[model samples]
Target: MTPDSPASIRPAELAGLDLLASAVVLVDSGGHIVYVNAAAENLLESSLKALARQQLAALFAMPQELEHIVAQAREHKFSDVRQELALERAGREALHVHIIASAMDRPDGAVLIELREIVQQMKQDREERLLDQSQVNKELIRNLAHEIKNPLGGIRGAAQLLEMELPPLHLTQLREYTQVIIKEADRLQTLVDRLLAPHRRPHIVGDVNIHEVLERVRSLILAEFPLGLTIRRDYDASLPEFRGDKEQLIQAVLNIAHNAAHALAARIEQGDAEIVFRTRVARQMTLAKVRYQLALDLHIIDNGPGIPSQIRDRIFYPLVSGRDGGSGLGLTLAQTFVQQHMGVIECESRPGLTDFRILLPLP
Candidate 1:
């Protein structure tokens, strides 16, 4: 049996290794693959037979760096701990992995390589940050709403008293001034109430079909912007129903689609604006530190001039807006509602395309 060939290794030698989630490789002193587990085969994107005879350099674009690591493992008394480094995959994109190289106890001078992707940890870290930030935002909004709520009633009542005390007939022209104050106060009260709605409102859960929610939002948007907008659907009919508040889902999607519609004013006038509602299934997804076997991906795409780079990052924050005279609470409330369902809303925008992706776990 060739010392470099791992297929000749006894089945007992492979025990417990196959069960590992991360890819593991066993190579001879010359760095010839003697054994590769199922995870390794998937990671390498090659069949067992093809991977068996592969060299470390053939597998990774940057073998010289890995070769140095293996050399350290052999020469040093203490084996090297797993370190995060970039490994090239199939002459394509770089794959980030935490790798460990240790010399095997036997005289064959083989080294065992263990690798796990670092990107998964990064994704989990990002989700945690977003969740923590969302909580902080909610607390800030609630506090601000309470502060504004107290002063608004006083302002509106004071304006009324001032108007009534004015010379009744002589001040008719100035009555318009008090009316403006009252009207503006009412408008602001409405805005503050909306800012507080997502927190104060109770979530009423029921069976929800995302397509139905999108359809409701689509019709509502079209009715409002009847002349200049076209809303398209790209749905997966096979998606199963989940428990959620249908009305809240409708409102969340509506807020996003409505904003997209309004942003398309120029395109609408040119009669070429488009908004697409896309749905698909994502497998083995993780959100909020929870690993889900499947997730529902819903993307709201717009062909408008895209979100302004300045406000893109803060669009989900209350009172942050990109347009003139915009209330800016639409996306904030939408985010709050989606978060209630344990989902996340993310956006990618450029010159012509703006895609809002909502990811929700599937039960």
Candidate 2:
């Protein structure tokens, strides 16, 4: 339909489509597009007007099979029929989606198709599992920290006492070894304290503007990587302030940014390191198996040699590290802080791109 056509969809109807989170595409019996919702436009990477001129077969992997399914649904007056299908889009990888097709009870015999990517379902499952594992890890680390703390104290005290008792002749060389023992024991003591800190620390809640937190981290990161790193800000100015611990949020973002900077050392040296801090309001978001009506979606992305795939799955686990000499506690601590605020952090990485996303409830 042309812009001047009276048969064109009214603005009120288009506004209704914009409210839907699911990708909804309306197709007529003759296999032509009649209407495509905002979500559908994004999923299909085409404007509604553009989609209206395209054939339905141009979007799916096996058009003939979908045509057959639609025919059976229409003949039987079936509604809410779902099928797993793949979408075929030019110059892009085919998306594996679960499609729900409902034959509208209209004379035009239109079909409403809703698409949800299968990978998103898998990621939801992974997020739930990761949260449960994080809880288990916290318990294990607490118990282990206590158990390790007592022995460390004994070793440090014994070493100090032995150092004091050493004779003058042999004291110098032996005292050096005792100093090493004391230093290592002190380091382990510090590690254990950090492992238990979150559990013991009091929660300080207040209204937090996410941008403010990002600014704090930005200043800190830029100060350290002053020469060769660029930290880009892509924040949503209209984001509402939410209640959370400002200090914890700062630490959480700082840890992730610091880790990204560490991973970008080579790129930084070559003067091409880039990190992006992005924020957006997500509607109808699900995190850790719990659905929220609205949420804060924050992404920390880096352009560096990405994380190793071998250890990618275990990156959030305590004490796991890809870089040599890394404590591997940065991400773990970051996850802990965000979890305390009823949020979740997830990572996706590959060669040349590494992204960490944080999702939290919004008012």
Candidate 3:
């Protein structure tokens, strides 16, 4: 065969294959790396050219299970196996990766191994678990609402009766106290209604232009807090309309943007508050453990004091709030509404910057 012929080409040709986002390494019989692909460079945090002649064991310190798998692959003509290995990348903590090994038929007696970061797998697992937990909570809330609503009405009625019996001067104070209780009970009822709204109403699935949602939210924010605040829109015009529950999605986006506006109060007072509503199309996204070709990416970013460190971790939990006079149910309801449409909401916050990203599958 000629030097340029495919059959006579070097083993590096494996790099040209359209592999998944996995680290691929080609190692010879003695376990010296003959070739490494771009994915491997990212996973291992080392350049492929620099690692060409390095021994695999020296570079990876593979786990016993992975080493055993590789050994078996060497003994057998071809073997495919999966195992987890802990690898330390430069300037990063040690990460666990799932390694899949298979023997190759190259004349150099090389084996091809693919590695995928276990962290991404774990994130998928966690997202599924959280979705299940949220579903359970929704059922509990529905049941509890049914159980509480009847007694709540009776209590409010009894309060009214007692106020009517009191003396004129004392009646005013008594009614004031009763009013507070009734007001609070009514507020709880509203919350319960909001929680049940999505399930009770038919999903109005339609071709939703995401930019319209952002525009409506921006106008509302500007109207409410026009002074010392700026609203920016960074939308991708090429994005297509997505099939989604329009009202529910509007509420979800509004809740997040409202929370950001509240956080920017001090910044607004200082005339430096900025809230950005950005939209894009994510090429590949896994929502609720299911992968899709394209998904809507909406970001609500604010240059505020950021979320409080104390409640940052539990921001999505019901009745958790960092601001005074905040209902704390906005985000919880927002999350519930989005999840109903098979989406996920994620938050990343630090001092002076807080971002809430929502991912919804496209039709």
> Local distance difference test, per candidate?
0.84, 0.86, 0.79
Highest TM-score among the candidates is held by which one?
1
RMSD of each: 4.2, 5.4, 5.6
After superposition, candidate 2 runs with Cα above 4 Å error: 1-82, 87-94, 99-115, 167-170
Tens digit of per-residue lDDT, candidate 2, span 229-318: 999999999999999999999999999999999999999999999999999999777766666778999999999888888899998888
**TM-score for candidate 3:** 0.75
By summed lDDT, the worst window of 10 consecutive residues in model 1 runs over 75-84
Better of 1 and 3 by lDDT: 1
| C-alpha lDDT of candidate 1 relative to the true structure | 0.84
| Colliding residue pairs in candidate 1 | 6-34
In each prediction, how many residue pairs overlap at the backbone (N, C-alpha, C within less than 3 A)?
1, 0, 0
Best by lDDT: 2
Cα-based TM-score, every candidate: 0.80, 0.76, 0.75
lDDT of 3 by residue, 1-363 (tens): 432223443656674643444578877766767677766886777886788667676655554555677888866735587777777666767788888889876665567888888887777777787788778877887787778877878877887787778899787777889888788878777876765665688878888888888888888889999999999889989889878877888888888888888888888899999998888898557798776768988888999888888998778777788888887778888998888888998888999889998888887
RMSD of 1: 4.2
